[model samples]
Target: MNDFSPALYEVLYVSTLATDQPLSVVAEIAGRARIANAQLEITGLLIFDGQRFCQQLEGPKKQVLKLIERIRNDPRHTNVEVIHHGPLAGRRFQHFSLAFSTVEDEDALARMEQLDGSAALAAFENVCEELEL
Candidate 1:
């Protein structure tokens, strides 16, 4: 019997910070998520460009879906838009449970916000390559 799974799942999304959300809340969320994601065997990167957030989560399909659902309901985030989601051949962020980055390229970030589907995913991939992580 084969025990290995064929692929891992990943979700890519962009969201806006809630009007009343404090900047300090990002650190708090990442702190808690690191612990929880590790337990769930999830790995991902979170990018914050001032007012917007772009995140890519990779793990078991079920767990990733559940986490996205929770994120959708979190009051600290609004306009949660899932740009891409599906099975991935491997983990893009295997080492970090929830690695974080803050981007300074407003123009690039703006382009990502306007894209959807594969284009959006491509933008995210470009951002990942540019990141030091």
Candidate 2:
């Protein structure tokens, strides 16, 4: 048998919610993502704060890009802006196929959505620590 591991890639993005009914819609999206992400060997976190979505996806390069393309084309999400995307040495969320979180208020959402690049990533990491996931 051959032992090989695919190159790992990660993507961080923020988007606006287009649907009026967020709770149910977000729930349905997360539920479907959990199964699909697992099959694709992806692991990450999804954060929603009423009007915005901040998500991080990590996996093999091709699969991660394809998943981001799908998210870009999804109607439920608008302004799908990728904050970061590139190689990762290891997984930040190895155990979760699609870990989910909700920002308690608009201030928290604004803080997360306002930045770009590594700062945005750091904000997400802070959330991960708070959630202890």
TM-score of each: 0.93, 0.90
Off by over 4 Å in 2: 1-4, 20-22
Q: Model 1: residues >4 Å from true position, as ranges? A: 1-6
State the number of backbone clashes in model 2: 0
Please list all clashing residue pairs in model 2, or write none if there are none.
Answer: none
In terms of lDDT, model 2 sits at 0.85
lDDT of 1 by residue, 1-133 (tens): 1126435899999898898989999999889999999988888999999888999999889999999999999999999999899998888888899999998786666678789888999999898888898
lDDT of 2 by residue, 59-88 (tens): 999999999999999999988998878899
Q: What is the lDDT of residue 14 in candidate 2?
A: 90
Backbone clash count for every predicted candidate, in the order shown: 0, 0
**What is the C-alpha RMSD, rounded to one decimal, of candidate 1?**
2.6
lDDT of each: 0.88, 0.85
Question: For candidate 1, what is the lDDT?
Answer: 0.88
